[model samples]
Target: MSDLSRTPLYDLHVELGAKMVPFAGYEMPVQYKLGVMKEHLHTRDKAGLFDVSHMGQVIVTGTDYAAAAAALETLIPVNIAGLGENRQRYGLFTTPEGGISDDLMLTNRGDHVFLVVNAACKEADIAHLKTLEPAVTVTPITDRALIALQGPASEEVLAALDPKAADMAFMDVATLTLDGAECWVSRSGYTGEDGYEISVPEAAAEALARKLLAHDAVEPIGLGARDSLRLEAGLCLYGHDIDTETTPAEAALSWAIQTVRRIGGAREGGFPGDETILAQLETGAGKTRVGLRPEGRAPMREGVPLFAAEEGGDPIGQITSGGFGPSVEGPVAMGYLPTELTAEGTTVFGELRGRRVPVTVTALPFVPARFKRKPAKVQQA
Candidate 1:
């Protein structure tokens, strides 16, 4: 099939009648025969299995903990030393000029740090990481398959298969066995829903996937619904909404930067583009990420021009990611605009087709997040 990369569950997906498409050099399913709308609905209602094996799974470890932490701090705003073992942190990769290279998840896997980076940017991330911290052993877990089981029923569905699913806390990771195979299960997801992402050995991925699919609440979803779900959840896609030109301040991700990594403190700054980030954190960034709600039925897409409200003013910001949000039950978009225009109810204009559609600057994650952060009974593996 074009010699592109394939996940361990590719065979199962093909048998399930999925429509395969190329994504980040991997032969991924865009949708099943039932289509994107159905899959999206299924994920919101029940549970959906997404093969995210293309994503980069890596381990960054070193005997020198403090040194390694500082080296990693130089590349991201997160205070690596602060995250406890088995705890995960969200962060961004900035350019030398204070722009985001990509956003990623970092889990302190006890002595070793686990990094799940974007698929397309994996090679570059690894190369850059090596240049930054060559002493740290960064090994890509190519023999693993990443799958996301998401939706309202995700926890119940997974717990039925593995009782351990109900015992892990949010943002925490635990090593467990699934269908007699060693797996790493985390209480995390991208759809703003209660779910888990399972990392399993490639050889057993297909077998586990089959078991999950057999569950009444579980359905095999594709990349198409995954995009819509994340978009509706107001999550940024690396190359699309976030890039070397975007910054944490503008992306509304400043919380990801720890206090130690801030402007002051003995830590100073080690990450790329600290000067710009510090300036923005102090003086405030002119632009910030905001949501938009179109007044009409027409949908405003990415790259559309943005105009300030009141008396038909000048251009301000543009749409980053926009589309009909199935969860929100209407058209919604995430974009950046002047801080003054970021206020809720701030009217804006978007050039839709040949007409300027009136839009209002709204809050993001238009749909409420259903993340299951409920405290679970602590259990040691």
Candidate 2:
């Protein structure tokens, strides 16, 4: 633990009685005194504050939007050039073989592009960005702290601090002043809830977090509940659900690739592994990721071999992520399964402790998402 890095909120986490643990080379809080179950429930019922400063925040600068977008397009299969200002999109960095290097969120910040990648992949991601031909600048914002205020009541809490926060739609980004501190806020989160990710200077993080926590509906949460929330939400965790060996098609994230980057668009097939990815898109992948619900109380876990329920059957795939979902009130998991068995209601078994645990293939997101989208405009004569 001595070699582990600490976030800007480390002291506050300790002061709040957080159980410290090492994750992605950082000393993070896995749970507070409320424990994982209560924390998970609190976020669902109200709002929860999470210190996600360990994640990477980077800015990509170039001479112009066209050059920067094109340079970024060469790395990922997304329509970066088409993204409007202040709007964000989810994307994945792919290898030449079409496997995912890392999953990320990209936002067009008018003058430059803002990228947020997984903590463990930030270094390599930055290095990869620097290698692009257009001579764009990759600037890592290590002096910033990211806090996620997530849950159904997030808007209420944040709007009190900055009224303009309520005006933003889902996946919208803004630079605002919160209690006089510069804050780069985004109306998005990983918990499948309506929330905001607040990026502020490191020195002001604790104060801002305290102000948010002072809200009657807000509580400090930890990584333990964060994991369960994401699992219930069916969001993928980097390195576990996705890695260098998994492609977007195999990861069930083909939706992230827009049509413009596909076969019949104006700009198509210039990204890494475009050939392999395009082929997979056309012909279908061998194995695809699917959600699983264990029939019994036993929780299926990672590396558990999946098999068909027939006698002397060979393993089909393996579980990548699994856990007990507080919101779902059951054991939920996601893993790779053969395309033939990827349909909902399919039967599968996971080997656990020398016994076969029966599970059913189900649609992802055990819990329904509560994202706040912009209301449709009304027209009158």
Candidate 3:
């Protein structure tokens, strides 16, 4: 194991026979003895507990939290002023040219703001936030550990510990005491299911993780299954599905940009990419993200060439994230292409193994989302 960047659960993961790999400068578990396929299926059927400590946990504090939040929103696209205490919102940071800096989660702590950003872009995110709000105290909670309890059974697991935790609705965060350690629990997940992401102190995180695992419905899940689960949920992965070169519109992420915060009306805080993104909002983006299903069992990989699927079809797009979707029972991929080629029934080409593979463009998530909504609305792919 490398000593460079290790999670609080590093020792536990090693003891479980996980195949460790380097991801975003941190030594993490990609898979375990159960393998990716089993882990993926297990998460779907039961609950998967993941140690996501590598993700950056940042806290911004000031007497005037609202003003400071508005300032931070200047660097990202979101309705920060709309956030109530202990509420969380999934958002993104954008560049001046409208490209995405990274996807993140912003939470209101009543007096402080807590942010969870991608590990790969955490350093840059900190730098950018400092550039925007120099007077606001910004501190990276590097000594914290995060764990995601994902699946339909998460309610039961949490209810066993604290019934109050089960009452928190999606996108809401609440402070809870776990074995004398304070933890920030949020009713949010990446697996298109009802779950919670817990941020606990590094010292007590391992103990809490073990306690969560002791539950019958919860099992240790490696990063391999986490990737597949998020893919099925139609979530974006930094450095792959999204990058500094990719804009929010092209990434099918305009929803992250609050409409009220656009330039036309008297918007709140003016972020870096406000003008460019507002333009894209008014006028459609030329290129957009699309999902693809290959004709056969061959899985698509990132950086694979894309074509128009004609006799002399030229390269038109590239796959960002792709693989065998366990739930779909077929090969599926997501990438960006010309807006004209993003139609659901449109056919495209994914060049694989020196041959062009027939592909059909489909809507995102590729699989129906099982997220719990008040009206039980299921967003079909």
Candidate 4:
């Protein structure tokens, strides 16, 4: 752990009695005194603050917004040019063979594009973005810390500091001042709840976190709870559920590719592996990612082999991400399965401890999302 880097809030996390562990080359808190289960449920019911500064933040600039968007479109399969100002979109970097190199979020921040990539893949992703250089200037932002305030109570918690936060809709990005610190905030999060991901200057990060935590509704959540919350929401963890070998189509992420980038659209097929991905869009892939629920109390963890029959058959697929979903109150998992076996309610068997356990294919998001898509109506005085 000595070689691992630490986030700006590392000391605060220690003071809060967090169990620190190594994650993505950083020493991060996995759980606080409340533990994983309580922390997870608290986030779902109230608000939880997460220190996510380990992720990469980069700004892409060009002669103008159009030039930058065009340069970015060449790298990712998303409708960047059509992205509205102060709005963000989820995108993926695809390999020449149509496999996903990484998944990322890009915001159209007026003059330049702001990107947040996975922590473990940031180095590689940054190097990849440099190819768009000359056309677009790639500037990696390092003097900032990222934090996420997530859950049903997140809006009210943040609105207490700045009333303007109440007006922002989901996927909307804005520059707000919290505790006199200039913060870039996005009305989005991984927990499938109404929340905000804020990027603030390193010097002000700790103060902002402390201020947010002072709220009765906000608690310090760690990585352990973060993983479980995302799992219940059926969100993909970069390295586990998606990676270089998995194509967006196979990962059930086709929704991220807007229709404008599809075949026959005005700007169709410009990104890497466009041909392969476009063809998959027309014709489905061999395997598709699906939600799984183990029949018994036990969890069918990641790398567990899946089979078509109860016994005596070779593995059909493997679980990619699995855990006890606190919100769902059951063991939930996600994995790839043959397209034929991907129908809802289809039965599959997972090899667990040398015994085959029954599992069912189900719709994703064990817990329904609670995002605030529209602004709240103001009450008359």
Which candidate number maximizes lDDT?
4
- For each candidate in turn, give its C-alpha RMSD to the true structure in angstroms: 3.3, 1.4, 3.2, 2.9
In candidate 2, where is summed lDDT lowest over 10 consecutive residues?
A: 130-139
Full-model lDDT for every candidate: 0.85, 0.93, 0.85, 0.94
- What C-alpha lDDT, on a 0 to 100 scale, does residue 51 get in candidate 1? 94
TM-score of 2: 0.98
Tens digit per residue, CA lDDT, model 3, 1-381: 455699999999988888999988899999988899988887888888998999999998766788778777778778887888888999888888888888999999888889999999999899888875666888899778999998888888877877877778888898888767888999898888788999999999888988988998888888888988888878899999998898888899888777668765556338777777788877989999888888899899889888986457678999999889888888888888999989998998888888888899987877666655445678899
Kindly list the per-residue Cα lDDT of model 1 for residues 1-381, writing each as its tens digit. Answer: 678988888888899999999899899999997789889989999999999999999888788566667678878878788887777788888899999987889887777788899999999998878876666877888999999999988878777867888887678788878888899888898988888889999999999999989998889999989988998888888877888888888888888787788877567667789999888887889899888998866667788889865346667889988887777677888888889778898888887876688888887778778876756689999
Question: Tens-digit lDDT track for model 2 on 1-381?
Answer: 999999999999999999999999999999999999999999999999999999999999889877788889999899999999999999999999899999999999998999999999999998999897457888889899999999999999999988999999899999878877999999999999999999999999999999999999999999999999999999999999999899899999989999999988888889999999988988899999999998877789899999998446889999999989988888999999999999999998899888787889999889999999988889988
Comparing 2 and 4 on lDDT, the stronger one: 4
What is the model-wide C-alpha lDDT for candidate 3?
A: 0.85
Q: Report the C-alpha displacement of residue 318, candidate 4, in angstroms.
A: 0.6
lDDT of 4: 0.94
List, residue by residue over 133-205, the lDDT tens digit for candidate 4.
8889999999999999999889899988888899999999999999999999999999888899999999999
Candidate 2: segments with Cα more than 4 A from true spot: 377-381
The lDDT, on a scale of 0 to 1, for candidate 2 is 0.93
What's model 4's TM-score? 0.98
Q: Which ten residues in a row are the worst by lDDT in model 1?
A: 307-316
Clashes (candidate 4): 0
Q: Candidates 2 and 3: which is better by TM-score?
A: 2
Off by over 4 Å in 1: 1-3, 64-67, 309-314, 374-381
Error of 1 at 352 (Å): 0.9
